[model samples]
Every structure is written in C-alpha cells, then in structure tokens.
Target: MVLNYPDGRLYSDDIPKKPAKQVRTTPPSKRTAQTQKKNNFANRGMRFEEAINESNAYYLSRNLAVIHKKPTPIQIVKVDYPRRSAAVIKEAYFKEASTTDYNGVYKGYYVDFEAKETKNKTSFPLKNFHQHQITHMNACRNQGGITFVLLWFSQLQRCFFMDSKTLDRHWQAQATAKKSIPLQVIEAESTEIFLGIAPRIPYLDALDHYIALKEQEHDN
Candidate 1:
C-alpha cells in the first residue's frame, strides 16, 4: 500500500517527473574472458546489488518489512510488437536519480540508505554522493526514521554503516574542509561490519547496534 520512489519521484496524484540521465546503447557483442574475469572478481559471487536484493527478499519473506529497489526511471521512445503478447523495447532513455538507492520500512521505521562500493584503499571521495541524496537523507532523518549510508571498501574487504548526520556535516564542509572523508575517520565514527555468508552485508546486526546506541543515548 505504501508507494515509495527510489530515485526521488515523490508519489502524487499526478504522474511523476522523470530524470535526465542518458541511456547508453551498446551493440550486441561477445564478451571476452578477460572481461569476464574482471567482472567475476568485482562481482565475486552475486553482485553487491544482487546480494542486497536477496537480503531484502529475505527480510520481506519473514514479514520483517517491505523493501524494494526502484526501477531505473526510463522513458520508452520506441517499441515494436513481434506478436500480440510480445513487445520489444527498442529505445529508452534513463532519468536522473534525485535520491539514494534503497529505502523501505523496518519495525515501524522508514529506513533509507545508499550502498556504494569503492576500490580505493584510503578514503571515500565526497563526489560519490550527490547533493540531492544528502538532502533526501536529511529529510528522512527529520521524518524520524533511520538514515545512513553503507560504504563497502572493496580493497580492504571491509564495510561500514555511517549515520547520515555525520555524512551531512562532512558533505557541507567540503568547500572549507577536505573533499573526502578518510578511512580512519569512518573507522572511528561508524559501525564497522564484517561481510559474511548468510546475510552478505549483515547490516541488520549493524542496525541493531545503531538502535542500541541510540537508545543508550536517549536514556542518558
């Protein structure tokens, strides 16, 4: 019953406005072994996006909460019908993303977070986040739900759950301060998560930690 927009098209009585992202067109070609190897290592088993989708499914199946990936907003310019039932999409263009990647409900809380992976060893570049995403996270926080980002440091094989509040502070400080938030700073302020088997990112455990920490703070 709850309709949420992933890329920031707010639900309304009128049709949502699409983004301005360009769509890339690639001719059908054979993939080489070298390309396959690179993709395999980068993806590992299932892609990070797929893993998160599966994790969301796991969460949903048990009635924990409803979470879904927003479809890439695209405007179909052309389509061909081979049969009455089969329609081929020939041309489409991508729309802009005005918000973070994933969002949904958990234990009455509306959770919003973006999952980003980087090969860099030392710091997470500030450019990875869009300004609108920061604004979205801030709005979610104001709505009293949990808003944060999950950063996957691929080279180090480590992940961290950082509160959006801190990220906002650093994001706004870019003009005067350093452009990127270093690994050391993230290591100190965020919940460092160990990538695991069953749950992949095991973010719920980190969520538990965040909840507990918040509760303790509220108590004090």
Candidate 2:
C-alpha cells in the first residue's frame, strides 16, 4: 500500500526487514534487564497520548465537556480485491492538512487544541508545529473560542497548557530568534497540569485556569 500527503509527497511507512540472525543465549539476569529496558522505551512514547484519550473518555462518561480527537480525511485512489470478501487499500492521500488534534465545546465556549509530546528536557522544537495549525488556532481565538496546546515533556514527566497567542508570538519570531521554546518560558507563561489517576492527564483543570484568566481579562 502507498500513501501520500495532499502535496503529493510520498508518505513512507514500509521499512525493509533485516534478514533473521541466529539467536544467542544470554545470562538470565542480563536478559531480564534488557527486556525491561526495551519494554519501557517502547511504551514511553505512547503514555501521553493514551492518557489524553483516557481522560477524554472519563470526561464524556461523567457528562462533562464533550471533546474528541479529530479524524484525518483520506482519499483512496486505488483498491485491490484479491478475494470476493476481502479488499485491500492500494493507494491513498490525505484530503487536506488537519487543523488540530481535538476540539469540542465546554461551558458554552468552543475549545480547540493540539496535543504533543517531546522527549527534550530543556526545550520544545517549534518544528513540531505547523503554520496552518497556528492560523487555525488564531482564527478560533478571534471568534471567542478557547484555544491552547497541551505539551508533554516526556523526559521531565511534565505537562503544560499554553494559550495560542503565546505560541504564535514565539512562532512568528522563530526566523530571527531561537527555534525552540525554553522550559523557563513555558513554566512562566503556561499552566502546569499534574497527572491524576482518574483522568490521567487532567487537562480540564488547566482549562479551568485558562477560563478564569480569560474572564479576568474581560473584567478588567
């Protein structure tokens, strides 16, 4: 199967598998340690995303704010049917670039945000973001929608909720200034979210803080 971006660039997912090699026995203690390390490394990337999904489910079940991850639109170009009852997609392209990851309404305010995780300990690279996404967030904010991003620093085990405006400010200056947002800036400008057991990410608590800040701004 072949997949492509809307711009016709090839989206490569197929990696050639290396030829099987002879297995070697190792000491039991060493083997166990290696297995544990491998498992932890593999699951590290998925922890943040899975936590967000679980949190969303928790919110939905309690009749809280309605939110969901947006589905990407794909245009299938070809399909092969080797069997009467089985069909395989042969080629497809993204219909368009997605705006953001998740969106919904909360307390009469439209909420839109992107969730991203980085392994960096000191900074988050701006390359993780796209211009179209920033534009979309700006447009949402202009129309009185709640717009923010949830950033998870995997190495530090920290999460932050930063409003779109702050993101855009740094984004625009990237050409002349630093290319990444420093931890210091993030800690000062964004709201920190402590992970909880029920709703693992517990992002809504950060959202509540943003709403309060917005209200205060309006009041003043």
Write one digit per residue (lDDT tens) for candidate 1, span 99-187.
Answer: 77789988877889987766789998887787878999999899898999988787788889999999999999999998989999999
Candidate 2: stretches off by over 4 Å = 1-44, 80-88, 94-96
- lDDT of all predictions, in order shown? 0.74, 0.79
Residue pairs of candidate 1 with colliding backbone atoms: 19-95, 19-96, 20-96
Off by over 4 Å in 1: 1-46
Give per-residue CA lDDT, model 2, range 87-185, as digits (tens).
Answer: 987886555454887899888889999887778999988987888789999999999899999998998999999999999999999999999999999
RMSD of each: 8.4, 8.0
Q: Residue 137 of model 2: what lDDT?
A: 99
